[model samples]
Target chain A: MSNTDLEDDLRGTFDRAAASVPMATDLTGRATTDARRAQRRTWMISAAAAVAVASIAAATFGLSGGRSTPVQLPVAGGNAPASTSAVETEPSVETVSGTWRPVQMAGLKALSAERPEDPVLVFRPDGTWTGSDGCNGLQGTYNIGQRGEFTAKAGMQRLIGCDNVPHTGVLQSAKRIAVDASTLEFYGADGRELARYARAR
Target chain B: MEFEEYVSARGQDLVRLGFTVSGDYQRAEDLAQIALMQAFRSWRKVRKADDPHLYVRRILVNAYLSMTRRRSFTESPSAEIDPPHPVPDPATDIVNSDDLWRALAELSARERVVLVLRYYQDLDDRTIADMLGIKPSSVRSTASRALATLRKARQSHHVS
Candidate 1:
């Protein structure tokens, strides 16, 4: 057969092959799985970022715990022009290394990784910390009391990559945790925490 | 358009083209999935182009080439394939299907891809070159070599 004819036969052969192959249920199973995969990827990327930002703030200023820099942070969708992220930003605390205790957070399943689970929580001596919350990595300010409650204040995260979960919810929850954990009694800003610890250990 | 909708519309055609190019059903599926995900990530930008589908095809060919290079010296899974056109046992119609599958799997990844794009996707050499980010000369040379190889394979199968 001529080459053109051979190409035609090859095409025919492939068509027949596709027809013979057992097809996945297009209505539910295969389609749903792909969607799930997409959502998971999105969530994974976002959570990693949020935790990074929240942790960075905690690491940078919370180590000092003396006083954080008070700066104007740009409010979202507030008729701001140019440099929204830079617009109304809060000031940071002075950099200092202290005996920072690592907050142990459990239940982070490392997806899309072969080995070595990512940091769910990390503590630096300068009283700084960073880690992911399952899906996102956060960076922010943290304050630990000699008593047990802690606060993660002034946090930000970047949302990128493919993940298969609701990003908005994850980010909001992380922020709320930081804001609420402001007391030794484990009470957040509104004073509501089920756990408390001393700063030393 | 929604990602799901786009996938559904182009899914079958993509698989077919992928199979033709990759010369293996399993590898074709992988190419399609990767291409689909990559396209989704940049859908906002790619979907606006004159031919979003072309974007995916380019990614497939480029991706397939990279994959082949990564495993250059290794034996491919399709090494044991039987040519598709001739059924050894017409008594079992399944043999027809198996032969066809074997034929596709036997083609080299490059030849398979060029043929698939040329015949199944109905893309000209220039377009295929653009999609794959290769010089048109390379596409022409590859296509010529692939056509000759495919013809020889088909003839040998027919004689045997």
Candidate 2:
């Protein structure tokens, strides 16, 4: 027989053979659900990995300090001295080293007044930090004293012009740092609150 | 088009194509699902393509080849003979349905794949070559060799 005739015969045979295979009724729904599940699984794995890395860095850099040593702080009205015991009870900078979103800024609000984009600050356990202030990228190294005092020395700042916010000033003037649960507070050298940020989950 | 709409429309055709390629419903479903999931993941890019269906078909073919490669390394040798094909009904227009299917099954995976794409899907040599990542000349030779094998199988069946 000719090749065309043979091909026709094979096509007929293939059709009949394939006809016996039943159609999958809910294949679309199953596939859609499976795809969504796979996407969720991927997101969950990525989030877990981020948390794991943050935790590992926190541990490696001694970001989490034991509460055995309590630091003293003078009271306002010459009353009993306030102790860091209360602050140490919760997760402070030592336990919270990750990306944080600015919730409130005190001194440098004018720069972020027009368009208040949530400024992101990332604290690395290696005494390094990097983030964006809705305008320019900020990168620098930081030092945390035993009393949870944070001192940051600016390293590099991009001079991109943006009308939203300029976080360079706050980040540069930040001297004291405190963490309460998911909230983080940055203080200037004058002991006034510079910026308050919430941990980005 | 939305990914869900695409899946709803072309999903069955893909499953059928998978069935034709694998010759097993379960494996076909797996291959279709895997390809569809991959398509869904890259829907933004895939939907913008000139032919989304063709793009998905390429993914299905790749997935099937990958699955077969993995199966080859993992599956243990079986000494038992394969089950006999069902007896063909004389009333059927196709006289040797069982023998044909059995013959097709006996061919190597690549040979069967080329035959199915050419005859069943009615795809051209260039399209088949593009899908299988082979040259058009290779497709012609493979189809020629596959047809020769089928003819040999038919003759052997007649003698037996």
Strongest candidate by lDDT: 2
Candidate 1 per-residue C-alpha lDDT over B10-123 given as tens digits, one digit per residue, 9 for 90 to 100? 766666555656656666677777677656655665588788888777767877876877735453465223444354555343453344445555567676677667766678
Q: Specify the poorest-scoring 10-residue window by lDDT in model 1 chain A.
A: A178-187
Clashes of 1: 61
The clash count for each model shown is: 61, 1
Give each prediction's root-mean-square deviation over alpha carbons: 14.5, 18.9
Write model 2 residue lDDT over B1-160, tens digit each, in one string. Answer: 9987897788888887787777777777888898898777557767988989988988887777766766353322211112443555543445565566767777777888889889888889999998888999999999999999888888887799
Give per-residue lDDT, candidate 2, residue B138: 96
CAPRI quality level assigned to candidate 2 from its DockQ score: acceptable
Task: State the fraction of real interface contacts model 1 keeps.
Answer: 0.18
TM-score: model 2 vs. ground truth = 0.54
The TM-scores of chain A alone, one per candidate, are 0.30, 0.50
